[model samples]
Target: MAQRGFWIPLSLILVFASFVSLWWPGPNYGTDFRGGTEVEVVFTKAVEAHTVRQTVESLGYQTPDVVQVQDVKSPSHFIIRVQEVSSVTDATKEQLKKALCLTTDAAAAVADEHACPSNARATEVTFSPGGDKISTRYDSTPDLEKIKEQVRSVGGINLRAAADNPQIVNQRDNHVEIQLQSKGDQLMDGLRDKLGADTVPAQPLKVEWVGPKAGKQLRDSARNSVAIAIVFIMLYLAFRFDLRFAPGVVVASVHDAMVIIGVFVVLRKEITVSTIAAVLTIVGYSMNDTVVIYDRIRENLSKHRGKSFWDIINMSVSETLSRTILTAGVTMLSMLAFFVWGTGVIRDFALAVVIGIVAGTYSSIYVAAPLTEWIDKRMTQRLGAKKKRPSGKRRAKAVTGKPAEAK
Candidate 1:
């Protein structure tokens, strides 16, 4: 307990260093937090990670991430992720508008189709302001296929169906509602053309996209959830113990989070939804340990009435040491199993949890318990100071040099 004066600040310094590191270089944000396209394809033959990456890069994408999926036999699988591809340009808008407005049903639409709106019959041509939407309420129900063909003819721009997302969304639509999409189809085509047709295949396993707007929302939600969890834990600890103890638990939890993130920063790995889940799990685990030791401290305080707060804290932590070591060791061993065998994100999550376990265990003792004792000691001194202060009128007199109610 006496050495805690040395330990607590050391932890703080370490956390500060981590905070700087996290912001300075920053963490690698995943597709879930940054708008991008992710395509999972099962290659008929083995392909190197760099080879796959180069194939995508040659297509003019900004350094796509190509990761080989493990635990598969025969056909190999790989996931490729790239930044947002299709963007609305002035040329796109003008060309799309021209395609919709200039082309006539007689010239372009399917023969004798009454739904096809000719260029003369088309009355209105309007584009959505501040968004990628072009609505054309026709004189009649326009031939959507003809319009699609016209837009498709506008070459140089890589565009795919709103429906053909990654593996063709199973939704039946009129193809009227149009929005910019990630070029998943183009990427698959590129892969097939560059590599072999047998290797790349027609349909990939899956394709998913996260737009910039959606990514921002997910990022904000993740940050808010983490904050909410920490605040609630602090509130629960305060109700369970007291203000002094509650702050210690909260600080210790933050300490553990910093350390876990620091481990990732050092390893130069990406922070994904899985990583966030692991972090939340670690917070709960560390909170449980701190709560256990604090409950013991409270019990000892009541039973050993003559002992100092510092002494009780030391005794309480000493008693829980066996439980802490055994619990942490067993939990860490399980995490190690996952780290060894689990692939990709699973491996990342396991490694994160393992780091948390070690950090959390140390924090329960050196950080949470010692700080709780320190806060109690300071609060006790403040209350004693209040007791030693003079009566109200005497205090007023001492402050103002004179008092109306002078005794």
Candidate 2:
């Protein structure tokens, strides 16, 4: 029981530190929440992150968030994230047009009517005459293969010439389809300049872009999901256990979530949709651990009615400690593998899970159990005090100096 002195203050300190971290610097939202662009490129050969970052910076853009993606199943890959821009610049559009013209000229004379169309608006490109304009409008850059397929379906245009010359590929598109042009094309050019022309032999593996409004919606959805999960968990615990136990479980679950978010903020890790999933997972995990300890406490109360409240709590915790350790330990090992070996989103997810498991275990033992004990003790004291007070009939008799008649 003396350990409560240490555990209580330690929990408070941790909760306080987590709150500070949450508000001071805050979590770094990734492309999913914060409107931005993410490009995943797989190189024919290995490339360094610094080289990639430098190449992106030289292209007159802000410092990019560059990460080297590694996984057992996939080849070496790099994912680059940059703040979103409204559209590619006019200069970039002109440059791309000139490059495309040059490619077309090499294949056929620029004056040749058969030469591939050049200078299509950045949003729409004419792949074949009398064919529908290829709609380039998208949240992100459209895939070249997808574009080719659309063109083939509409006009049966030959893609061999465009495939041979990369410049002929329209990479930019405005929201309204006028011509084919996209920010992705600009990024591709920049990467090619630095990583060697052959590095990006094909289009990037992936491209994602989100506007401000969409990002806000995503951010709100992520937050609402976690909030809703907590509420439901609280309701479930209240129904399954005593109402007094529900608060403790809810508090412990929230504590686990806050601590994980705080660590992410402190480390400046990007929060993505995967992060929301991790937090929800932590909520469920923390609740499970707390429930085990709570069930033991309930059992101990019934089995050892004469024992003091603190003593019963201590006994219950002591009995369940081994089970809690075993469960959390095994789960932690799996999460650890993901944190160490997985890449990108998987690594982030694993890191959150690892932090969460540790926090959840500690809170279930020290925070949740102790809170329930305190609440129960307070309720007992209040009931004891009420019982000691004079009855209303006795008070009336004393005031009137006469015995009250039976109703």
Candidate 3:
């Protein structure tokens, strides 16, 4: 038989790494959920997140936040958020696109500087408010025709082009600001066709950006959430099984979470606020699978005391293999739909769920159940050999031997 103890050390290592990242994650969320520039656009028709993401990508930005933020009182809503980075020049183009798409009073808040002072060294182009005497930022001028083509496709108009001179702020930290023309709000209303129908409009003039305040809150909340979740799962497992089984399940859950987070870090996927929510959701999902497998293990142990530890564990996993596979398949199908059809905001959320489900399934069979059996065997050997307690009235039956009552 394979040595069951071998998996415990690996489980512990994975859990420790994941717990560290919960507090010290490197990526930051977008302003929409985290509070940055609120660019609200009302399209000529309904739009989808993928199209918006594509348009933004074409404009030379990374994926922006596209969420349905609504005012409880008003039927009207809008999609809000910032730009992504492609090439260096695209960043400036992104800012300009954001300025033109504005449909909120917040757009007017952008500075009219020729180019942002802080970004001067990095950005190849400059930004200025749309008009004459606009200060130029970059040495090389961008193709205005290309810019106009993409802008028009995404429902952008009002052509008064200038250099990509980005206005700089003295915030002493990293951030971008955008200002819309007086027609900004109306302009956004015209571009609503780019935002998908599933998106609900948000209140106008709301500022969205990732600042220190939102960042810290996001960090703390993610940390606290993970801690609380792990604690609760451990408690629940302990209550249902013995304390010995709890450690194994917790290890497996943490392993699943860690592998997902590590992959995200390596992939450099934007870890947004929604990403944290996704992590928490995945944790619960992973625990659910672990619990189901564990339940089977306890049942098998009761039914077959004469079986070897490896046999019992293998049996439990095999018995539930069909259920686990079906459940995982159905859950993944739903997540796949969200991922393929959903917008940028929740795409990460769905991706995280998919990763967690796969990892959870593997850990339940290979990690949790196996580890539980290993520990149980170790405990039984130690106690059964060490103590000479009789098969008497008081002691309950060990998994390996007959219970006192039965004897």
Cα miss at 66, model 3 (Å)? 13
TM-score of each: 0.80, 0.74, 0.53
How would you encode candidate 3's per-residue C-alpha lDDT over 1-407 as one tens digit per residue?
A: 26446755666676676566546664444552343344655433445556655664454344555655333433243464553211113354655544333223333323532322222312322443221112222222333343343344433333333354223332343223323232323324434334443452432444333444555687777778888898899998899889878988787777887877765665556666677777788888888888887788789889999988788778877888899999999999999998877655677789888988888887887787777776887898888876876445544555436546553
After superposing candidate 2, which stretches have Cα over 4 Å from the reference? 44-48, 70-77, 85-179, 199-201, 391-407
Count residue pairs with overlapping backbones in model 1: 0
Candidate 1 segments exceeding 4 Å error: 2-6, 68-77, 85-94, 101-148, 157-182, 392-407
Ranking by TM-score: 1, 2, 3
Q: What is residue 292's positional error in candidate 3, in angstroms? A: 1.5
Backbone clash total, candidate 2 = 14
Give Cα-based local distance difference scores for all models.
Answer: 0.77, 0.72, 0.59
In model 3, the Cα lDDT at residue 376 comes to 82
Worst 10 residues of 1 by lDDT: 165-174
Better of 1 and 3 by TM-score: 1
Per-residue CA lDDT of candidate 2, range 1-407, in tens? 65778987877777789888766887788888988778888877767778878889998779688888775564558888888544534453444333233332333533542323333213332231211122233324434443343334423123333333222333453232323324555577667877778776568888777766778999999989988999999899889987889888888887888888888888898888999899999999999888888888888889999998899888988999899989999999999998898888999999999999999998998888888888888898999999877677886787788877778
lDDT of 3 at 358: 82
Write out the backbone clash pairs for model 1: none
